[model samples]
Target: MSEAVDWGLALATGVRTASSGPEMSMTEAAAEVAALREAAAAVVEPVAGITALSAPEAPPAVVVDRAEWIRSNAGALRTVLTPLTDGERQVGGFAQPVSSRLAGLQLGLALGWLSGKVLGQYEALPAESDGPQRLLLVAPNIVQAATVMGVDEHDFRLWVCMHEETHRVQFGAHPWLSEYFAGEVAALVRGLDVGPAELAARLASGIRNADSGGVAGWLQSPQMRSRMSGLMALMSLLEGHADWVMDQSEEVVPSAARLRVAFEQRRRGGGLFDAVLRRLLGLDAKLAQYREGAAFTRAVIDQVGLSGFNKVWSGPATLPLAGEINDSTAWVARVRSM
Candidate 1:
């Protein structure tokens, strides 16, 4: 296949039947999704204290299957990875073709696996020509997760909606964030100088050194470190804020406590293939995103109150730096000083 081949579609379409079916019919699923969307929207502003752009312009939420989620994100991923595929450093070499093919194959495998794990995602795109950005709930995965956690289906779905809707309000309140995040991703990709040979060598070495945190430790150059620091800080802020908002709904999901416990255990309970994927994708660090970031958000809110904590949304500069993500006091001091 040519470098421009549609690997995302190929991979996504290949295993469409692997994901489990939802408990309800398609029509019933749509109706329930709509109801849940309204339910989640009702709490958005009150819980987040981040107002939507306009009542009508709020991000539209959709219920999608695992394949749809994969396909939607794949479009974004392809756009982001184009620079890598066509990089200046990707000159002709003995292993150039293999390296490129490996990159494609690994990405396909990762997405296919994650298709079963992710319950929701918020795609903060620039307003499309036809509509605003959409928040997606992957129905099958949500059902599966609810089943796995043994939580009430209704309660679990609503809980997931709240978290995903909080993400919508976050971007809707600050439309600039979509551009800012996209810029960060572009800048990080632009900074990569991976030659074909290095790419091949890294992949080949990945399995042999899986114990030392795999690619993470191997790819710890200063530039990569800086990029990851910025990226992680941003993600922690987004994710932590979402969790904080979700917990603030009018009616609490009593099972949320147990759900959290189940999720924490799940993160630590992956098999070897899962572990290898986490290492390769640097998702191991995401474990800290939940724990440390939530701790930071909770501490800031406790000290400053919700209104004062809104200072984080005042500007990107107020967002916690990497070191400060684990040190809420430091972030509080910095924001308050400003």
Candidate 2:
């Protein structure tokens, strides 16, 4: 049998290079970090009398201690999900090759890459920008790296491993979400209307407010708030479902409850650190999404039972829409009325 290759580098390189042509150069592609940083700064600039959302709560324990968590749970996670993988213990989409997982990573990276693409295609980027055209995953969460760490650190490591693995699986299964998020961000970027004068004035105003609380002031804009809310909703939908799935399989995982409670506290606390980070990073605790999605799944299960809910996974079309998330009452009524 072939040796198991590390999935992390393959995943990252694939995602970073997915859109670039065979010979594409870093010089040819614009950077995304600087652009996103500018956008982040722009969104946080201060306007008069604007107060920030009460510093979104302390993010769950995940961000503060994730590096240690993922290393701990790696083996158990790999074992519990073994049924989904090939004989080599490499998991991929249903009936797909392990290498196909790289395709999934591409989807997540695409949304980040679009930031650079949009800035270059449109004249909206700040001058002197230099960023990579890919989404960056902090190393602690990357699979292959976490896998090699010592077993003694299993508790913290496994928690992060499962969380990231869930992310990878979702992206592999739901390619549409990647396309949708990218489209939304690109649309918003193209819709920018800040002229040079307004930009300068706002930057000046932001500088004055910067001393008050760094970049919290700019985020007070109604438009910025609205956009941030929408993205948070989407992130909730994604992360929530994964968290729920993890919960469902808790019995199979010894440390499940510990990790679950830890993560719950993060989102419930309004997410990690800086108020702007909570909002702009688009990371939500996903408790609401998990409740809604799980309820929807349960409604389907109650109506058709587990077999029927499983059918929903046959394809994306069967998945519930945003409205149907908690609307199990409708499903129950329909069943009874029949």
Candidate 3:
């Protein structure tokens, strides 16, 4: 069957759209990369200690520019969306090539826009796959964000490593998580087999309800509702846990407190156009995940201590439900009972 998205086109378009930022000479960029790698390595033990999660000896973090970031994520996207793009099912009406190109262009544009915003990411590899799991630090974006926030660049780099390293530990500690997340993504993509008319209706409905749930409301179809919620809850748990742990970095990072203040301000500071773009891209929802997830993390840790809070990684059953994310008491009670 014909592919649904031209992955090559997506990569090219994304790279082109993601303009470079925070100019650096070759030596400066190399120095930043080396420093970030060392920081990532240094944080592994601390993150494991803070969360009481043990990760296997992992490879050093790969530091890249914006274009490389886009390329790496584009490849991951293709892997996740393979069920929809490579199977017998296809988005109806448009010819195979036309549909593929359109999908690629759309995906490319979104990735391009996001390339500038992300600082570091932990890309979980499939359990059965041979490729080594990757922890990526976007060097230029990290420098740019630090410069924009006016914080100590070295401190900020280590701070970002703390959060990203937490994610690495989260997945590494629970090997099943990568496969589980991949399965859910496949199920969600497979559910998007609707024709153009149904897709259009869904889009209209999504736009109307965008304010209510951000990306969840916008992209949700009946078939994808449960999967989306599960994924969102998992993401909330992961991101929130990382954020909470990163806050405890004041001991090692002297400027951690100041960095947090500046970062939060920057997260909340944006123009009208930026706001619109954020809402459209579900970044607003992402921000909520950080806030709500961190609140839930703090509340649980406060109530039951870090050991009890670590129960969240026990299994999928221990993960917070969609409603439970906003209700820490409910999550705490449910997990304790389980």
Question: Which candidate leads the pack in lDDT?
Answer: 3
**lDDT digits (tens) for residues 32-94 of candidate 2:** 223323322222212100111112211112221122222222221122122323342332323
Model 2: weakest 10-residue lDDT segment is: 118-127
For model 3, give the 10-residue run with minimal summed lDDT: 269-278
Tell me the deviation in Å of residue 66 in model 2.
Answer: 12
Error of 2 at 235 (Å): 2.8
Cα error of candidate 2 at position 279, Å:
2.1
User: Per-residue lDDT of 53-108 in model 1, one digit per residue for the tens?
Assistant: 22335645777777776666556655554555564544554234555556555555
Per-model TM-score versus the true fold: 0.79, 0.38, 0.86
Location of the lowest summed lDDT over 10 successive residues in candidate 1: 269-278
Angstrom error at residue 307, model 2 = 5.9
Model 2 root mean square deviation, Cα atoms: 21.1
Candidate 2, residue 292: lDDT? 60
Each candidate's number of clashing pairs is 0, 24, 0
